[model samples]
Target: MMITSRNTAKAALFLILTFFSAASLWLLLEAEFLAITLILIYVGAVMVLFMFVIKMLDTDQSTLRAQFTRYLPLGIFVSIIVIAQIVLVLNAGQFDIAMTGIPEKHDASYSNITAIAEQLYTLYVYPFELAAILLLIAIIAAITLVHRNESRSKKQNISEQINVQAKDRMRIVSIKPKSAKESK
Candidate 1:
């Protein structure tokens, strides 16, 4: 929905809501940490950033309409393929992979959070760090892009404004007070 949406603001809003829904699903699956992280990172930070960027940037809507028509046939084909794949997956219900041994059931003492944290920090540390790095890069790129289009001189200088004297703002000229006698 976000990808195909015509309005950028709406798309950003949709993306934020989608992330929240996915987070809710994760919470339902007992993945509390992942859910919270998704909310904080994507909803709290990234989505807001995307909205700000979209609002700041100027868009040409006419170009979009032209492109939409050009891509309609290909888009419809891809959409049908995607829908078919989703239906097939739903009809299958579950994967057919056979477990080599019976899986261990969680006991009353087992901590889901602890287990997740252990695997995430120890086993998946590199991938986790890489993702953080990627996010950092994206932020830097956004800042650079916005900054590139703005002139430094246009930025306000508080010190310069405060230090400016009356002389700099106006000139007090003593033009002999309009002589009424000279005005015939």
Candidate 2:
């Protein structure tokens, strides 16, 4: 539905539905933490961002419709290739329980979060740190882009403001008083 929807808002709504379905699947797999994270992060935060961006864009549907036919053939071709690949993989017997033994059940006291943290910190520490650094860089880039056009904006210099003197702000102008007859 997301891919087929002509309206951007409807597409976003479909995407949110897809996210909810994925969260439900995660719940079925007994990964409650992952399910909650998926909903909160993707549906709550990311989808809100997407909706805001889509609204801000105010796209013209006519232009989009005009281009749809141009890409239709390629879209169908790629989709067919993907579906064929999925079918081939499913029939390969790689996912058979006889080939890959059933996973061992953990004890009642076992914490998935703890196990995940252990693997992330120990085995995937470098990649995790790299991802964090990339996110930090992306945040910095976004801030820079937002402030790029604010050259005329007023920005207070805290040090200069703190060091400002009363003398600089006030000018003592002295005017001589003249008699009424002399002024006339």
Instruction: State the displacement of the C-alpha of residue 79, model 2, in Å, after optimal TM-score superposition.
Output: 2.7
Instruction: Report the C-alpha displacement of residue 31, candidate 2, in angstroms.
Output: 1.4
Model 1, 81-131: lDDT tens digits are 999998899678465445244345655677777998899899999999999
Per-model TM values vs. the true structure: 0.57, 0.70
Tens-digit per-residue lDDT, 13-63, candidate 2 = 999999999999877766667889999999999999999999899799889
TM-score of 2: 0.70
Top-lDDT structure, candidate number: 2
- How does candidate 1 fare on TM-score? 0.57
